[model samples]
Target chain A: MNITPNEYNEMAKKASPGTKSYKTIPAAFLVGGLICTLGQLLNNVYMDAGMSKDTASTVTSITLIFAAALLTGLNLYNKIAKFAGAGTLVPITGFSNGVVSPALEFKSEGYVLGLGAKLFVIAGPVIVYGITASAVYGVILYLFKLY
Target chain B: MSQRISKDTILLTNAPSILASAAVVGKKEGEGPLARHFDIIYDDTTLGEETWEKSESKMQKSAVEKALEKANLSSSEIQLLFAGDLLNQCISSSYGLRDFDIPFYGLYGACSTMTESLGLASLFADNGLLDYGVAVTSSHFCSAERQFRLPLEYGGQRPPTSQWTVTGSGAAIVGQSGKPPYVRGVTIGKIIDMGIKDINNMGAAMAPAAHNTIKTFLQDTNTRPEDYDLILTGDLGKVGSDLLIDLLKHDQIDLSGVHQDCGKLIYDLEAQDVHAGGSGCGCCASVLCSYILKRIQEGVLHNVLVIATGALMSTTSFQQGESIPGIAHLVYLSDSKGS
Candidate 1:
């Protein structure tokens, strides 16, 4: 009572329970590593089936995205993400879910405003920053080559 | 006549009685510990509705109907109805109760809608304005999640401090004449912000408000924690409840013995995967309408101080870097009238 905001914040911080990073970190690592390993296996399988390395890599990514979108539609991706923490998030599957979830959720609003507009709500920032950084890198590389 | 006891407390002289109450919840709540206490527990979260918003409205309607049925009165018999929900424009309450012919007042108290509406209803009944009034509020997990946080299927991890929004609704009928468990007094809370900005940790943001209201009520009533059988808080969850106990301890008022949080009571923390506990308007509303009221009616609990807390922050406000301002309204329910 009558305490400053800073004082109350300190008290609350001490009282509130924190996420157990020790458990979550390991879980994330394991699940994230497994996902990567699956991608590698899929790439190898595609290459062995006569596809080129680049095509196999592209196919692997498409397969993973499709799988993630399907899981999201089935409502299983979030449950796994809840347990796996950032493991599910730091992968292509997470990006797929980011697009698919909002698409499904906002479908009630309609095709244009709901699903079409809000399709990239979660993944929008990543795409924006990702393209921006790549474009900046490309311009720098071209300048160096010209010089 | 009802008298103003202190700065924000009002002592209801007429002592309006709670005629009947009902709680309706979704499948997850049906799996909770207090599941048996609830009147209707739908195994389907959608309740056969096409949309989650529609399902939430249906739940609220079901709760109101159940409460009216228990009171042996129809919606036409009720003079006024105060209802709200954790939705944009309080659509759940409006769309849910539109079919009813009763005069309706939609409130937006975030998670504290139940007690806010109940307090207003009790006040109106005590002042001889209405013969019967109903207070109802609701929250749906799917609806609240999509509106407040993220899409249901989004692959994001909830922090340990995050609470699950309850998919439930509760309604209570207060009459000028009924039985025990009368509405004795109410202590309206002032907004208290402790500068908590984390959307995930709403419990911490709201704990200060709960402390303020509970302290104010006790001071105004000249009573202590031991005076009441139970001092129930709305949707503070595990984190907020602990913080509330610690905050009260700073003032030499220990509440570890008699204090219970509706968030913690609704779900089995150990068994259920709910990180901190259950939250949302329905968290306390369903618990208060069912288990707490049932005990009070059965004479198991004579005196109870129900303090419903809420973090009054919207997604827009949070995005604009505003702290979550919290409020708690106290509604005193007891077996006998005060001296």
Candidate 2:
């Protein structure tokens, strides 16, 4: 069926059955609490698997990013975003989702430049700053140890 | 050129139904949607004026009546009627005001009509050329979308960057200085054309225009981001608003604290489903009339810079492979100054 722009706009004005919640405030709390619980579990699992504190944190980050990318690929992330509102955005997982979603979206434009770089446009600076700061801290620690 | 230009003062302001009904639609299939009331109503059954040729006059007449009621000035007392709309030949604004017996200055700024109209009217009012003048602009979703995008029945899913066209109208009256509220300063709008061709992606097209205009206004006026309580853009949707923020950051202009895009502020995402949000001349007009104007009157925001932007492209022109040339007009409103 050829739905027009006005028709599309009109249909959009209608509430979607998927995102509507009767007990919105409680639903928000529940969803947010569950996401946090999963994050805690992932942190424990990473430590139990023999990874150091820093390594476990990094591993959790990678795992969360991959999961978000998978959900984005399945078109489920957008749906969840609709339901959770800010809930989907509060966790480290949301940031991972943000980076991975755009990367996957631009995949069709080729891997070398499009998918590889455009995906990290918004979050790239944070990653760069993080690595640089960590390197500086590592150098400081080594010098202190020598003394 | 026809003479008889004089300064005038705005007696009243009206922006009824400019804000679309936040109808909880899917919840109830059929229910009388709540109304957003205003001072003037031209038609009991219809929204505003019927046809495009008659729309401008309808708006002008309604505005004149409202202004007259407030300022105690009759139709003959006003020297000129300055008005326009988002239409070819400005039929909606011009023809409707034809019977009002006043000189007319027809303007077309796509959606930037409100600011442009107010600016011109205020200039005349401030200069003492005319005693009272009325500036009006409007946009009908059915009329505008058909002219710019697809037909009303084309049910294509909106991209996350798309905006909804508002079916609304707004009118403001400016006169030769007034009490409490008056025209403080008018920032002349600068046109910025990024030469973006894809009308389907208005966010990319108009974002640059908005960024450029905001930058120029701040530079030319020597006003900083923190100068005004609100730095409102016309109709840049969610995507465009985000892009505009990034662009502004390049110039060391961060409006993150006190900036709001009119399109995004009017509707709720879950309720309206207006993907990127709302657009069109009506988006800014209705917003200006209903929300911003009300706040200005209530003394919530001390100073406001209303910047209305437009994607200057038609469907026929786009089909002919022409790019969308965007434009934006800026009007600074404050209670501190008189006309």
Candidate 3:
């Protein structure tokens, strides 16, 4: 087992499917569109059931998040996300996966530190910055109205 | 031969041959483009176990058994088993491989465990220390995620720079006699820290170490990027892969044509929703056993250089706000040399 580094240096493919950046446009558009369509369908169904549009939209988002979290607990969302990619991410489902994946991953650590703390590893920033930005915008609108 | 070459490289004169190898992956990996290359894919990540950790252990055990079976060998034929994982104390390897009677040497290189174990197993086989040995490693998305990051039930978001820990196991059997694609040598790396503390950004943390290892290997061996048909890095993902190129270019070494990262190869960026691609010990292990070794066996590739890289960071270290340390190990696998 003795030799030269130069020999090792001499040692050393087609872009195998996994190595190269995969072509994901069709899958992304198709999956993303399908999820949105599903949301629309759910909204229509809720409206037809006599719920207001605003309430139906909110309920639809809540249902998607609930479904995503449930799937995450069953360890199915990651599988779907794998196939859908941006399709899953662009929709509300992606955000739900973001929140659920880490929480599920951290279950063994304990409730306080693992589940409660790490629950927002992905979406925490979005919630924080998102709420902050909205509040700032609200204040600006209020000032503008007064002027 | 005494087995010492330059500062970090070891040349194996006897050149142990890889008789067979097997890759067992989770459902997500099974859906990837190289699905056909894998030997087994589990629909259930837990492999029917009560917990993900136990399931990962079962996966490792199955992978080793499958590899030996493919080689037409039995447990008695293997003298030692070199295995590891990204779990605490390498439990995925220890508990998984415990049933086997072979002498066990558990290793830890985080994602680079594949090359680290391969290097050791090759050293033992090539030097006549053993007639045969198995180099195996595994990482589970759930098991590793829970142990290394957070609980599975916790709702959290992963940053764009983060990589998905692959759930898979790969085992390779190296014996005194076999076909080509022999183990030529290894360049064991030294730990390097460039003061990168972001656990989410492995590419930034590990790129410098890869550069250091590659430079050492090149200088010690007096070889250029053109010498090898392929230069593969383990789990550098896209960002780290780019950084490796830029760092090497500073030394006038361009790896544009030959370099590929296993992390970048294992998942789709957009379609798979893998931000920086795949990581963990299984990232390099599964891909190397399936794709790279398959091509070499087909004679599509002559000589190849595989430098598996690892980020030596733990949840404790990150929690303490310590900069991550990185290492890279080089192994030369060639199809033409012995033949």
Tell me, by lDDT, which candidate is best. Answer: 1
- Residues B1-339, model 2: lDDT tens digits: 112211211211311111111111111111112124344433321334444324434544454465466556677876776677677777767666778888889888887787787777766766667766777666655556545653332212344556776555666666644443455554555555555665655655677667776777677656798988998988887766776786688788998888898777766754767777777666676667656776777788777878888887776788899777777777777755522
Better of 1 and 3 by lDDT: 1
- The window of 10 residues in a row where model 3 chain B has the poorest summed lDDT is B150-159
Q: CA lDDT of B177 in candidate 3?
A: 73
**Better candidate by DockQ, 2 or 3:** 3
Ranking 1 against 3 by TM-score, winner = 1
Could you tell me the TM-score of chain B in model 1?
A: 0.99
Name the better of 1 and 2 by DockQ.
1
Estimate candidate 1's alpha-carbon lDDT, on a 0 to 1 scale: 0.94
lDDT of each: 0.94, 0.62, 0.83
Give the Å error, residue B45, model 3: 1.6
In the order shown, the candidates' Cα RMSDs to the true structure are: 1.2, 17.9, 8.1
Better of 2 and 3 by TM-score: 3
Query: Per-residue lDDT of B1-339 in model 3, one digit per residue for the tens?
Result: 436868788888887888889999999999887789999999988799877889999999999999999999999889999999998888889999888878999999878889999999999988789888999999999887777775554434466678899999899999777687788888998897777776877876777778888888888878898988999999988878877787687788999899999888888777887888899899999999888899999999988889888999989889899888988888899996443
Candidate 3 residue-wise lDDT, A1-147, digit = tens? 121223222221011123222545566678789889999999999999999999999999999899888888897776666566677887898788888777766665688897688779888998999999989989998989953
Pick out the ten consecutive residues of candidate 2 chain B with the lowest summed lDDT.
B21-30
Task: Give the poorly placed runs of model 1, Cα more than 4 Å off.
Answer: none
